[model samples]
Target: MRIQTILALTDFSSPAEQALERAALLAAHHQARLQLLYIAERQEAKFCDPQARLEQRARQLSRRHQLTVQALPAAGDALAALHAAAAQADLLVMDNRLHGRWRWPTRALGLLARMLRTSPCPVLVVQGAARAPYVHVLVHAAGDEDSGGRLLHGAAAMHAGATVELFHVARPRRGLGLACGEAFARALRSRRQRVQQLAQPLQSVPHTRLRVSDAFETRRNRVGLATRGLDPARQLLVQQQGTRADLLVLAHAPRGVLRDLLQAGKAWRLLAGPEPVGCDVLLMPQRGPVTARPEAAGDAPARQSAVARRWTQAT
Candidate 1:
């Protein structure tokens, strides 16, 4: 999506700081306005001036990134404030509570997953160490086709030339006592259609020397989730291990792929597993059309040139 405004929520912790840095870099990359929000607990607000602290932090980031940084400081409920602020932003960047070192009252993953389910805008969950630009992106394309496609296109815009692996798991073919041949043929046709639908967008991204390749590769595997009783999340992790991506994208909705995955708490398992994910996880909510910012008539060339130069130098 055209990210004109990015909102970042922080509690001033280490994980929050890392998320802020990522938000800043993304804001600079897209030439978008960066808004920093800090919500003070009622007790803390009574003791300290949260607005002052927020303004001070905003000024620092603005100078550091050479971009306008808006400071939004509020007291009381944090999630309530976050939801209100998110309405005006194209994307919300925040620290996944699961990554926090300290113990929290609520399960961080559950909270974040709920936010992912309800947030009006896309949310990027930053985990692990900072990687300035993601070079390898692994996308779990198990949800709606439109949502999955938008997530990929938006990612391509952010990290030009990164190798994107579109991974999906199809339900394993079940035995049909009667009409076995017809059943298999129908299943095969369905699988083929799903692959084409997911791959259609990437095929159109033009290749250029100045930018990263928009061309993406797809991997589809069949698992007998129902009959074999396999874990969808574990299976996904196994595939992700093989790809070794720098980022993982998931389009979460109540029903469909996410329901199957998250119902088993797979999202939490993926992030809080013993082995580190070793990449950033971006969770996007399924919504209407996701389009890039509409540029001025003459701005396209300049923007493209700037993006090309950045990627060229980075590479």
Candidate 2:
């Protein structure tokens, strides 16, 4: 996953702005070319006003990041416009809508999922506030192996010598084990090594830490979701990327992750805020090869694709 070029699609909302902030951090961190995109709502050909607004918005976003921006207004669907523009992208970053009419179903996550299913590159979707200090990267517990492996592989490949940490934040109750002491230590060790195996070059990439928190405060039915351990995964990734990570990479988790986010109503946070403090983020979607995972005999060659690589630019 070489993110040589990145595209950020904005709807000109606060959420979109947040996505732009994330893009800027990434552009600055990786030194990758950043393209800011705005797709105007379709209007009659005689109407130039919307196109002008779109261009103006694109320029504003581009100037903020100190890079070239591309604002496009098409006569068709907003999603179609974005999909057309992102043909050459290594990654696409967008905010998740959290409230009112700007909720998930209307936002780009579904489109993101469509893109993910067949994207030439990976897609990263951030809604609401994620966690901070992204020294670690977590893959979804039930994600495809390549999706899981790519997170570690990409981190290891990057020459930054940044430590790679991977952990699964499971929903409360069922998936989470509650034993203490040795049981906890053993579980952590096993999961950490599993992450390392995918990360490769164990010596070069150090282990951070992994934890399992109950998604809910208690096992009983609750009025509203109080995201406990696993809930923080999305929050940490979204919030921490700008400040701590040069960039952050994550695969799409199962519906459980999205559901919790929706319940929390943090969708707006996905687009409005400044990027992970100082650092930028790379929100990646799965874009594995035709045979993403292969047998050791079959996979070694592709596995040897290249060490995780980073695209760096001067801030």
Best by lDDT: 1
TM-score of the candidate numbered 1?
Answer: 0.68
lDDT of 1: 0.61
RMSD for each of the candidates = 13.2, 12.0
- Over 1-315, each residue of candidate 1 has an lDDT whose tens digit, in order, gives 678999997767677788888889889878999998884232354436767877888899899989899997566667777788889898888776654343232233345655665688878888755657777777765443545567666665655556766555432222211211222233335566665665555565543111111111112212223233434455556556656777787765533334534343455667766554666787777665444223347643544454445334323
TM-score of each: 0.68, 0.52
Clashes of each: 4, 27
Please write out the lDDT profile of model 2 over residues 117-180, one tens digit for every residue.
Answer: 4555656555433333244443333233445566655544433445444433332322223211
